[model samples]
Target: MVFTIKKVINNNILCVTDAGGNEMIVTGRGIGFGHKAGQPVNSDAVQKIYHMASMPVQQKLMDLLEQIPYDHFLLTDELVSEIRKKIPYTLNEGLLITLADHISFAIKRKEQGVEFKNPLLESIREYYPEEYRMGKACVQRIQEKLSVDLSKDEAGFIALHIVNAELNTTMSITNDITRFVDGCVKVVESYYGRTFDHESLAFSRLAVHLRFFAQRLFQHEQESDDSMQDQDFRRLIASSCKEHYECAKKIAAYVAETWNQELTEEELLFLTIHLKRINLSSEQTTK
Candidate 1:
């Protein structure tokens, strides 16, 4: 199998996806030497991937993952313990390692100013007032809890985790999407003390989809559910995603009218990709 590497940093870490749809974290100084965004890598090299050591400050490592990425980097256990104590997320080896890889890439992406598209670009403030509030609150919390200064991107990462915890029992994004919509509606209604109306529905719909799609894009099921394949489950997923996004768009439009602030470009970018996936019509939802 041949894999195309889309991103690389420090001439070490890589994000590669193969024809078989496997995305993995690979590390080595020379790995990126001859590579470019669309360059293909040999499967044998992928199979040869090795494990690395963990840091003494893994908790601080977790903190950085909550803010940025750090693959094969040093960390403190106290920092790891502190974050583990605060967040209810299960702390295990796989999660710890994956997060380390993720944060490193995300930090590199941040430096590049990757803009997110908001489906509620016309009226995001009304649809996701709570997110706006949460964004503000996250900054405050980071300021008080963290010893070092962090940027808006870091605050947003922290906010994303909070969003994840509220809707998901496990990291499985399928379950998260189903619950995320209901969760967003509940939070917004309580915040404004009223349920969403039709006018703001488009924006609200976008909000839920973005939250769902962004989280799922990076997640993969470790094992295939035999039952899901036996029963035409891909169709189910595709239709459900379509419904989810359509509803989210309707919700976003509704929120725009309710809130007064403008939606950021970042939000719209996320919404757009989600909508695109759902709108693929007849394509298998899961790859």
Candidate 2:
């Protein structure tokens, strides 16, 4: 009932082949530290292994993953299972290897108490009600159903797909994105003595910025590159933010006046975020 530490790699994953030609892909964290290949892997370093339906391979992999005691908020099985739902060809070696690193970093970030300011905070609340609701709805309507308990991260991914499809991604739609750009330009021109057309440097730059921003928002990736240093950009953000701020307040008033619900900090933040993006005037309208 003994095992040998096959090898340790710096990339935070272990490729171990032991007694009887059984191999395991184990996550590297708090595991046989400062040790190299052939260094006997201590029993308490492994968490869980990629289990297979094949009983022999499954049992061996399970035992290998079990040698480690503490779980570090990552389940490779969970991630692999989840991603496989969307991209059918994700079971390839490349995805397995790449996602292993991705999952590790994400889990480690959570361990460090890092938080993302969810832009869809209100929709996540008053709109979707809960993460499970959106996730389950997407899962239920799956073109390719996966019979796995989808993780919250997985559900969030699916929810994003739904959002993207709702928002059209095209050149004309991007022109609609430019309409908001025009509004911001007007706001900026009214403030500054500098005169410039939408085709000018200031407006062109911000328009490009907003085009990308709108795309990311539709994709549900709130954290994208949208800076506000130049005058036009700042003005654009200010105009956009002001509109959203007003919309948030309006929503707050409605929720309080009608629904009788007092919106919390989390709820209001995302509401403001989404409203600003939605109000940005995208050609998401056509096609």
Candidate 3:
């Protein structure tokens, strides 16, 4: 496919249009160094092609390319590639713009010795372990490539960015989900009168469950009525594990009061089941 250069963004980046007039941003080493509008692009030199369907996102990326050093974009591109490999979801293309902007600002803040703490760091680490691990890798890569060492807090922030991209949601929504999950964990701990070991597999499973639960709450997704088919099992769990079942009730109450979202019977049933497993896991660990 022949690509006509629409604009030269930098020595390595160019805004180009294909034969069908679909605009895209392409990046490569010196791809745009001597290129001009209306010229044919050197396809062999194109290393990355950002075919963002959103015009606003495309424009934002182009503006960012003009503002920040091309190297930052390159670093973020590599990080996004790694993220894709680690995650099961297809990330929004806008991740390139958002993450590149974040890394550029983070580097500048590091240079000025200004560090911001991520309040949701712990929650993010618990809720999005895979993304958090990738975020830590990103921090290490930044240090190796740009000589700027960032804190674990930055890793959390980066993880939230990945979450935002994966869910196609805003950072505020991601923060809300993380905070909600943290609140639910605390509710469970308070009801049990003890903290579950954070590193335990039970806790990991619970965290994963709560993360998606919070997402559903935020999105207002409800379990279908067919979920009631497991009523017999739900009743069995509720009766067999009364204390854990009560703890699950407390969490459900907390969810209702905090988020104003009512949990369905299925949600309550699942929560009770998870709480039962967690309680049993804790019991075995103590014995």
Listed per candidate, the RMSD to the true structure in angstroms reads: 17.0, 16.6, 1.9
lDDT of 2 by residue, 147-201 (tens): 3333455445333333322343442343333343343334443433344443334
Model 3 residue pairs with clashes:
none
Q: What ranges in model 1 sit over 4 Å off?
A: 1-72, 75-79, 88-93, 115-154, 158-287
Order of candidate numbers by lDDT, starting with the best = 3, 1, 2
In model 2, the clashing pairs are 46-68, 121-270, 173-283
The all-Cα superposition gives candidate 3 an RMSD in Å to the true structure of 1.9
TM-score per prediction, in order, is 0.29, 0.26, 0.92
* Clashing residue pair totals per candidate (backbone < 3 A): 50, 3, 0
lDDT of 1 by residue, 1-287 (tens): 66678555435456666677555455444666767888887655542332223433333433443344232232222233344565554544434443344344544554576634333222223433444345445445434544333355444443333344444434444234434444445544453344444234354465655454434433532233344453354445445555544444554554454432233333433444444433342133323
| Better candidate by TM-score, 1 or 3 | 3
Error of 3 at 132 (Å): 2.0
Model 2, runs deviating above 4 Å? 10-13, 27-29, 42-45, 51-287
Using TM-score as the measure, name the better of candidate 1 and candidate 2.
Answer: 1
Tens-digit lDDT string for candidate 3 (95-146): 9889999999998999999999988887887778888999999999999999
By TM-score: ranked, best first: 3, 1, 2
lDDT of each: 0.44, 0.43, 0.87
